[model samples]
Target chain A: MTKKNKSALSEHTGISSPEITSSNAIETLKAKRKARIDTNTLVSSILNKNIAALSRAITLVESENHKHLEQANTIIKACLPHANKSIRIGITGVPGVGKSTFIEAFGKHLTSQGKRIAILAIDPTSSITKGSILGDKTRMETLAKDENAFIRPSASGTSLGGVARKTRESIILCEAAGFDVILIETLGVGQSETTVHSMIDFFLLLKLAGAGDELQGIKRGIIEMADAIAINKADGENLKQAKLAKVEFNRALHLYPPKPSQWSPKVMLCSALQNEGIKDIWKLILEYKTKTTENNYFETNRTKQNKFWLIQTIENELKRSFFNKKEIKEALEAQLKLIETNKTTPFAAADYLLSLNKSLQ
Target chain B: MTKKNKSALSEHTGISSPEITSSNAIETLKAKRKARIDTNTLVSSILNKNIAALSRAITLVESENHKHLEQANTIIKACLPHANKSIRIGITGVPGVGKSTFIEAFGKHLTSQGKRIAILAIDPTSSITKGSILGDKTRMETLAKDENAFIRPSASGTSLGGVARKTRESIILCEAAGFDVILIETLGVGQSETTVHSMIDFFLLLKLAGAGDELQGIKRGIIEMADAIAINKADGENLKQAKLAKVEFNRALHLYPPKPSQWSPKVMLCSALQNEGIKDIWKLILEYKTKTTENNYFETNRTKQNKFWLIQTIENELKRSFFNKKEIKEALEAQLKLIETNKTTPFAAADYLLSLNKSLQ
Candidate 1:
């Protein structure tokens, strides 16, 4: 059997099957044909709200093969009519901000409220080491095992936004499966949180009380983008500081002027470890939803995010394509070599590369 | 007289002549014209290596009047031929890194060796209040008094980068005024260091001996870009800790593979206040010049930097023009309002704005 057909059969069973042995090519070919038909049935099933088929479709979408994106796109398009029903929330915090613990408690809370939750984790590939912890499932074991909860770790990838694109597409799959809430969790390492914020309806930033760095004007810049800021670990002695932080954040939030939505940003203290403020957080999110939906901010924010992604995607593609040409590549290296040797300047080299690429094209 | 001629007369003499009174329309115009002519002559004299003219040209470049950019650009272009001769270095650190003392001692050493020097200070601007310290010249008293040295404090401006761009252009003006070396000092606050690095030939990052946060990868990213990491405040008691910090930095530097130029980044210790190791730092830079010049890295690096600026300029212009359109402005504001009110998603809003702009164009 062909490699494509063999993989097709493996994709049929909702597993990232690592091994494929086609000793009986004829039988394997027949099975592959059956798998292809099954995939179509699975796509339809997902669209019809079949949870198992929805899981299978997401696995297919995460595949690295070119054929998988095509198949995933097809499945997503088929499921589109039934998708987009869920409220997607993105939560980001520094490493020890109780992201997984909070998510588990939050997922359970949503399930108790008759809402099926899907959680997707986004992890960035370290540019130099090319290693990722890929520890999403391990961190949220309870949520992963819960019947009403769906959890997926990030697929190892090149760009943070690349991982986000797949997760975004997978969100459509989950929503089609009748999941009413989707929660995306990302660590505040690097710029991945920005990517996460672009894909979600509301962005929540969790901060530790006293250990916050003063120079990190992140609170100022990010607070403008966020729907809410929660000072985590706010239970015991930290409660006073947390209150102080909330007040400070409220002041900072006020400094931003009234948002265009005419909604004031919310800041609250929480003990994610104690699960004390999780419900209140949820209530605040609901408030955010009701207010934004009533004022049309929810849909407008999502639309703006989509446009941001489209432009970003196009620009990245243009840069990659322009740099990937053979002549341009050779000239760039040659120019860098010259730069290294003190014979030319970086700006001159860049100009040379631009002109070379233009001429080649 | 035209507005150009009035400015010329005002520039040659510090005080405005009574005949150039502000009341008479034509005389006022002539006075403006005289000031302009005086400024132009001053700019020309500065272009021809007059120190005062160079300083005034920089002041004009930093002015709010839109017409100053035209004159500034003209002055910069005229001085371009005399520029690119110096080893432009950017030194940055947080407050209390002994920046003023270091620059004074370093400037003294360079000037003592018969190397004319120019120091441009880029002070941080308060985002909310727009307040700036703007007092580096007073701090570097010795260097300020030295005939061989020129010290200019931060120009009033919009951004750190804005200040840097104007300073970079001013570096050309200073170089034309016969300065052989230009040192730009920036505040070591987050991305500001990186911004300064992007504009210079060599970048130096200064840190204290007892910084606990150094290991959390705060310094690692910038370490890769540094030509040298100098542990300052390395006195008697701080000696051991400084050595330890140097060792730690060396380890971190090792993680970064050799630069494209194949230059091995160096880490050293210094007591800038005590005037220790100042000459060695200059020696290292001299060695860098010798090595890179011999290997052609020096010229190529400058060329590449210019190319980078060109592309950056083009990209900024494209974005500016896109936003400049009246129709695009209306659509964007409308879409942003929708996003705020939840009527549309950010993605959809961006898409709508882009399409509207395209159609309108």
Candidate 2:
């Protein structure tokens, strides 16, 4: 038997076949390669300026799968030390405000100055609306083809909180990849701007001339969050109107209480359409960075933001877990019916539901 | 048998005499009475308009003892069927805006119209500040002595949410006790007004003429929540400024979105110190009631408010239970430290703390 050394399959078939040899060990090695310690390898690749690996890591971070989330946590933990070295800027405007044009122009300016820029979006409704599909690249053709620029569309999630979380994680990955400037774009008309504001170093608001948008911004509390207001489209016949808007926004920005940064907000005119006055806006942000950094508000604000996220995450997950249970869903319906029938008070019903959850635990 | 009855106590304690009686049986009867469900009796008494029973029930509601809360729940569950009959009005203003006088004047007006009124304060009291104490009664002396009115000071609690809950339950008790009107008062400078607004049918904000207060109101979003703005201190030389403020506030009110009740908020001038414009305010409220009721918005809004309260109670209790646990507290501190040292992300830290809490269950 030793001399023959026949395989089991060959013996069962009563045939001697040396050509039927198989290497199960080799296949096993190949199979185990991806499953083994991908987190460390991905972090090293991201640090090595490997864009493909960075994109893969972000996909894992955005995945709703349980196992993917665990892997993403490992990668995020490894990347945290290398992260937070870049300047984060948030840009917002309503639809038809030339956000795409402004971002492209702003990004081109930075890249020309030897800066690597990354653009991320926080629109939860992007999947249905003017999403970042292949057609979006056409809107920013020159920037999309630039070697120093990376553009990722908004992550799709059913909830704003969920999407905001993924974008936050993606920022870490992008920063680890050595992006010098990160522009976070969001619509100025909703809560997304507020969420984006909490995560950025400087927030910029863009406005077209005389769109009746200032009142909308004031009513939505967006004006208070803005660190700089740029009256875009300040070229051709729009120049006169844009100048007027700048003075109006200047007056509006002054009414806000002094920022904790101790840096006064400004209103500037620019023409993303003509790529005019774009560098001045960048200079203003750098000035804000210098002022806030000197006053130590820069680091203090980040610390406060981190604390906010920690508490927000725990509270949100607590509610999600409590509400997601099958038992809770069925019992909550019954309790609400009891409430409508006048058989229970809201407080009493709340107590009963909580007690039921406790027992389940 | 008689010898044995006397001997048990004496055998245990040889100093016991005949005069030393033990009421183990009768004391048990007295103790068991409160342990029994007094819900039905309290409900009947409340239905009969017994103010003493209402007061006792409210005391139970305000009590911190676990047993008392349980009894309070029973009483509230019984009162739920008879509650929601009266309109709840929330009155708010700055500390020096003569809120007490306005409430007194407002309370007496209703009582004189043959309406039984109940006034409750929700200031979330502390040791300092101008709290509602004996001086408060002196401030509202006429209304306090009126047979048709009931005035209670703010209930004390460790948290604003706790105080709000107690006051809300007290509102139910008052309504079941045949109160035709319920006034819930809170300070305008803080978060309590928003909490008060959620539970009320109408919201009233009192302002002083030309006190540089409208800007503060707008900043706080109190003006947007108001159903009616009443300018107090409108007598004598202040009358002209009050008229000017009325126009300014009217312009400001028009800028807000249309209210769900289809009611345009009114800006009225009143001198609470002189009891001016009091009758017109009442008539306006009456008109509002009739209009909202005709369009079915009244019932719809109440249903929405009930839903809000139910979800609010559950969410609040869930957070309280999680944070109150000693194990979660220690582990959360460690997790937060990990976040500070960059050993974990906030999202990751939240996950770990939540997992630690899960194992605790």
Candidate 3:
């Protein structure tokens, strides 16, 4: 009847597709909505110790989208009260120093003690190598598989400051989700270590004994910042050399004045692959925590770190806003040329540029 | 015209005050006005190699008055084209390291060769100690008396950034005054060394031979930054220890990777008090200048330093403007407390404060 009645111009449907609005599709839609949970539900779920929710929140924090920034801030602010409960440990070393193996073993030791752990990273060079530090989850198979362990790769971006900010926020989320130990791993070769050091309670620098028994790249500033240095691969034939390296580092560590925290940095030997000395390293960290806590350095250091981030965030944003402006970018190059040619002093150029920016504002 | 007549309402003036606009007083006023020269006159007089004008210009550069900032900027910009013609050397040592003796000896050596010299200082701790590095020009008595040398104390300010900026601007004034060599002296024990290092072509660390031979404070980052380490007080009874220190510093210097300058840092034994090895130290600096110039690192490094100052100035000014705001000051304290109580995340608080700043702008 429809074919006959619907002559040339008439339009008619033969049958409505039943599966278009089926119960499974509705349930699937509901699931999709559940998966894309809003900030409040995400916060609640994270507080409820949901790993999926925590992961999603971190992804939101690491996102590059401007729209996600608001949601990320909302989630992070909601989680702030639950944060700052964990001891953030920063572990760093050169690429071949067995960082992954060491971290895996170290993290496993923590989980075995019934401690929930989260590992994050801020590889300053990750923007190029895309995070050689923890880019490969397979590197820490046992740890990643543990229900109590959450491993996050470095936040991929061009600026170390941006990546650092992301990782810092992620630490808050991890702590909010009841992680007792937050391990931040970074490459010791760059500016990231300083950033990692500022955000962490204990900084552990991993080193390897050279063939001549000298430590590699003593990295003066990083070593000065370290709470403890562990000579990795201190097993088998490397034991004697490792001991020598430890002594050398011990002497080098003495070169720095007492830290503001008044805690003397220590040097120890460790074999990550052989799982030797891992316990001793952890014990040293525990000892550090105990002493620093007793002396009130732990809480005071946290307060200092809090204030540092507050100022650092403001300064970074201020510069970012100033430099990201199209007019400022063009004017900056011209001003630099002026400086190079000695036509303008740096301060005068800065003043001129700032005046330009003020107009822009 | 007497007092009785004035009392009677005659309004007669007493005999005119004879000294009121006398030729001698008028000439004195003229001299005072001449001493407080304008920026153009300051620049021209400095370019003419007048020490008095150079000193006045530097004083203007270091002035804390807001109005002086503009005048100082004008003088610096005018002097800039005449700058970059001299080698800027930074000399630093701990308080007890015989810094004054070494600098005086080194400076005398330069002046003896008919090379005019200018010494500036940036003691970061100066605001408290009022510049212990070069606070008293009497410390460099002979050099200060030398016709070919000029010495200025550290610019006094609470912020190292402010002091650094003032010293940096004064470098232009000194260079314009036809100084053949500029020596920037800073205390090695604090952050001033880094500030001085960033502003100079050559960084010389003055070390002392200790009671034993072990190098004092091996000073990792500074040692890495040094172009040469001169073990001062290396004569008489300390010669053997100084020899040992030289060897030790030489070994320690090798621990650092090659610098971008491509010139290896050297360690030498010197006795400034005895005037021993002063010529050799000067020769070493000449060699460094020659090598770096040939490699183009000299020019490129200056270019990099120029850019660093440009960005650093803008960033510093941005923070200064923001934090100095009355609203920002109050909001910052409130935000800090909120952060302490975990009522807000740093980045979120940063956004809120930044937005607050934006609205004011």
Candidate 4:
């Protein structure tokens, strides 16, 4: 099919548009002719560190089309052996915490050290915005212009799970494309922070100084997930308050039960705007990486995260299938009504609903 | 069938022996004839505050026997209208934190105020020990002897879900049995704290004075869930440290995001041994109850909890059914092996496995 006709077919069939392939496939022949270009072409290109091919492969991974799924799977499987070679770091902070500026500074520092960086995001709210908050490249102008830096915004308009799964797959493609550092950014609100935390080697929480409101909007659980917290915008007059906030955060952290990682979470001060303390932040991350790697927590955590994602994927798929059943959907509404009225206990209602589905037997 | 014959039949069928009704049914008539006595009898007896009947009803709720499930469901449904009339409190602490002593004192105080208190525990670890820590009533000598108090140990040897479901049902029965206060105790070690925290109207965390180890073994998440924290052993030489600890705890708690309950979590010093601050703790609970009730948080929270449990029960049942599938089980084992060997991505393996299951289709 012509590229135009292929996309028309895709649209008709509800497949997401294959952005890069369209141009070339249009200049090519029929549908059967396209099969001649195997997933190996994509795999070889990604392995050769071709950015366009890497981006296209990520698009395939993110596509909801069942048609592209098999090809995406093939490409990801081929890339797997080359993955896990990079350091995956998760960065999160509330809006207005200068996350983009911090990333630009951090990315520049790493690239100066001859490190290739790939930045991905897991923004649950992107669905509402219809585009990621970081979709605008101007936010991180310096890093966006750097050849060694690859900055991809959050995949918009998808469930957190969907976004997380795609981003995780994209990380593999990025690593296979020869990136040495993966920076996964997430908005501090909602469950995205936890999602990002699970997939990364090190988790950094960015906070503002002089905001007793610091812990106000962020969950204590999220704070506890941090491997280190950096008090952002620590330049000029904010310096003193940032140091004090650092002390307070350190004290608060001490009151927590030690993490299973056996590495104590550290608190630091940084000024992304002034490009101050950026190197120290990177140093802290390197220190953590070295310590956890020595204790084997770094590798073990990745393995555990793999197992966790496996179970999580199974559960999500199971829930989707069960809830998608026409009978279950109807029965669940009735059972929820019964529960809301307090006429039946939740356990009994669950039993009744399960009984309605013979497939469960 | 005769009582002896019925029990023999039960043994043959691998059914658990009916502890309370066997003899009466044996003296009366056949197995089917005894079931005709109805769950109403259990409900009415519980409504009249018959302690023995209440205990038997709880046992029915706790039973793993599929035969007793319907009866338990019916009894719980009958008791639903009378439930939620009492304050349900969850108490947790590490083993040496004097939880039982504190509870005994707390129970005595409530009864002294003309309140009838029922203490129930959900200890998942009790099964491993083969005896509940609270199973020894001699530990709470004063409360055990108090006529207005009813103390029951954890139901041993069941999954956390099973135990939590039973204890939740027991709370309904206790409230229907005219108990104005329901105290749910759980060891601070595991997921039981989160379970207990969910069912109760208020959660109280017990701590020790001089132990910087206060937060050592307990999860910070659990601490965040607390409505109040009481530093125990606040007597004699420990008084100064207790006061200091209380202040420190207060400051630590202040750093936490405000709870949805809008009641700031209070930290106080209490000597369960000396009975100091016991009344004040009760007053704190009363104040919390008043504030939350005034804001309608009490009712809204209960509703939210009901919905939460409803969804949790459904998810648990769905997982149980899915994992219990023979084909899925075998496939999962194979897939996990592939995962461990890094042959397939977890998402791909999950997709392949889900495709293998007809039910998922």
Q: Please, what is the TM-score per model?
A: 0.58, 0.90, 0.87, 0.84
By TM-score rank, best first, the candidates go 2, 3, 4, 1
Isolated chain B TM-score per model: 0.84, 0.89, 0.87, 0.88
Question: Of the candidates numbered 2 and 4, which has the greater TM-score value?
Answer: 2
Query: In order, what fnat does every candidate score?
Result: 0.18, 0.71, 0.73, 0.63
Maximum-DockQ candidate: 2
Best by TM-score: 2
**What lDDT tens digits, residue by residue, belong to model 2 across residues A1-361?**
4547677645444556564335786677765577455777888999997888898999999999987887888888888899988899999998888889999999999999999998998878764476643237778889999978988888887678888889889999999999989999987767888899888999999988899866568756788888998998899999999899888889878777898889888999998989999999999999998888899998888777777788888888888888999999999999888777667777888888998998997
Q: What interface RMSD, in Å and to 1 decimal, does model 4 have?
A: 2.8
Point out the worst 10-residue segment of candidate 2 chain B by lDDT.
Answer: B126-135
lDDT of 3 by residue, A159-273 (tens): 8878888999999999999999999998767778889988999999888987332323444367777899899999989899889888888887776679877789999998889
Instruction: List runs of model 4 lying over 4 Å from the truth.
Output: A1-29, A32-38, A207-297, A359-361, B1-29, B38-40, B213-219, B237-269, B283-294, B359-361
Stretches off by above 4 angstroms in model 3 are A1-37, A130-132, A211-218, A254-266, B1-37, B130-132, B211-220
TM-score of chain A of each: 0.83, 0.90, 0.87, 0.87
Instruction: Select the stronger candidate by DockQ from 2 and 4.
Output: 2
Which segments of candidate 2 are over 4 A away from where they belong? A1-32, A128-135, B1-29, B35-42, B125-135
Question: How much is B67 displaced in model 3, in angstroms?
Answer: 3.1
